[model samples]
Target: MLQKFGFTQYESQVYEAIFAQDQPLDATSIVNYSNVPKAKIYEVLNRLIDKGTVLTTMHGKKKLYMAVDLQSIILKIRADFEKDIEELKTYKIKRTFTDEHIWTLKDASSIASNIEQLIEEADSSILFLAWNEQMDKYRELLEQKEAEGVHVEVLAVGGLQSSLTHKYSLIPMIEDSKLEPSQLIIVDYAYLLFAGIEHDSWKAIKTTSKPIVKALTDYFYHDVALTQITKKYGDQLLQDEEIARLLARLIY
Candidate 1:
């Protein structure tokens, strides 16, 4: 554990030997307790001092070394880790194009975890289309993202009540329509995730491909438009012969 933070074996031994004592120890005593070679003890002490893991002081004419407190070292390590993480968050790689790979996630657990991560990564907007059960699975995550100022819009099937801005799917009104419920989500226009239940198991695929993302985003937008149009002109649109014919040609 001590070596994990860049401590050499000799330095770690010397520090532990000194830390086990109630007071600081001189070079000779440190070498005796740590089993470090006499020739290497001073070098180890100097390195530990440079790392701020050990301190030095004079007791009369003899210099003594002491290990820093364990809690202090832990706090310093935590601070360094946090600083690195913050710096990493600001870094952006310059890439001319996105990778064209679509990753498949098998099983319900994998899909659920991936969707949760995508929702958490969303910084701007989340466009969702899903049935009640699928919507319920991620409803809290979507709500939390919305509270963090991410725009969440949903096109929901069945009667799933949520605080998000959503439109009801017309498939539910078809009465005779037999459509299996599925989930589609686009996050920040960068990620697309689609999943459905098959044979009582979940199958999902995710991608950052530009064409796929744009196609699905357009699909969600068109669905939203259709829902609004149907709500506004339900009877009138059905009465129009041409519109009725077009509606009949649509796949339920």
Candidate 2:
């Protein structure tokens, strides 16, 4: 585990042994205390000295080594690892997709984290179809996007008899749904993420495909418009059931 910080086993043992003492030790003392091979002691010590983990001085004809401050080693190792990661990230960064492409996120266990990323990526608009369970799972991210000035509209479905709050305009569209408890997210009119938590795993398909996006957007708009019509005409339906049935049959 410590090897990633650039310490070999023998080198780590020698370096740690020196740290365990208040006084500096010669190589012979480090070898005995750390149980490292006596032959490998000076070689490991030299490497540690080069890494600034160990400091060397002369005591008459013999050499003594001391461990550097623990805090200094920690800071140096962290900076070195961060620099390495930045360098590695620069090689062949792939960040584009075709308009016809689709991507899938298949991890059900971390599905909330994936949704959080989608919410963060949204710039101007967000449309979501959420169930009560999904609202609980992703409440903070939804709130965050609302604060960021994205125009958020949601169609809330089953498991809750009422809305989570009235702060966001929501339409209760729960007669029946294939996407019940499944989440449909459209971000910035550019990307779509539809994810469902299944019995065995989470299955999701994300896309930038124009045809698919357009089709889903149309469906979303139709339902939203129908919800408005229902609210406006509900009281008028009390006078006659025939007209109500006809509108239901036509819209549904």
Candidate 3:
């Protein structure tokens, strides 16, 4: 485990051995307990001390070494990692050119993270369509954006019980959906992310392409409109044979 944090093998062994001891140990004692080569024991101890993972004390003419407190070391590591992340963020370049390429994203976690990022970056509005679970996952974020004056709208697969002004409709138009479960999101009229299960795996495509974004935006608008219309005239539409046939042909 210490090696994962960049500890050398001998340094890790020495530290563990010292930590396991009740008191500080001399180099010979550490080598005996850690089973590290006697020739390399002092070298490893010095490196560990330099790294602040080990401390030294002078007892008479003898130098003794002890492992630093585990919690202190862990906290230091975490602080360093966070500092690096903040510094890395400052290096991000603002793009001057329009990137119209569609990029594929795989797995549920990846898709969710990307969507959350897009939502967080929205300066104007967020238009989303997804299942109830997704709506639940992002409802707080959407509400936050709404509070910040971003026009937030959601079309949930289940119910429209949220603070955002939106619509909801069940997939009754298709009797049996052979299509995979999917989600749609448009952010600031610029970013578009469309995701669905494909071959039993989560797959998504994201893009900033103007044409594609406009096309999907229209699709989302029509979907919301249809859902609103269905909520009002659903029974009547289902009652008509011709309308029912056309509705049955409509699939995601």
Tens-place lDDT digits, model 3, residues 127-212: 99887767679888888888889998888775556777554655545533453467899998999999988888889999999999
lDDT of 3: 0.83
lDDT of predicted model 1: 0.82
lDDT of each: 0.82, 0.72, 0.83
Compare candidates 1 and 2 on TM-score and give the better one: 1
Which stretches in model 3 have alpha-carbon errors above 4 Å?
Answer: 1-71, 79-94, 170-179, 249-251
The TM-score ranking, best first, is: 3, 1, 2
Model 1 C-alpha lDDT per residue in residues 141-185, reported as the tens digit of each score: 888889889988888766567777653655455553456667888
> What tens digits encode model 2's per-residue C-alpha lDDT throughout 1-252?
447666788887887899999998998899899999988888888888889889999999999988999899999999988998987644442347666878887887556666666777677888877666676566666666777787777765533343333222233333555333467778777778888767757788888898898888777677566656666876786368786665554222
Give the Å error, residue 128, model 3.
Answer: 0.5
lDDT of 2: 0.72
Over all chains combined, what TM-score does candidate 2 have? 0.60
The candidates, ranked best first by lDDT, are 3, 1, 2
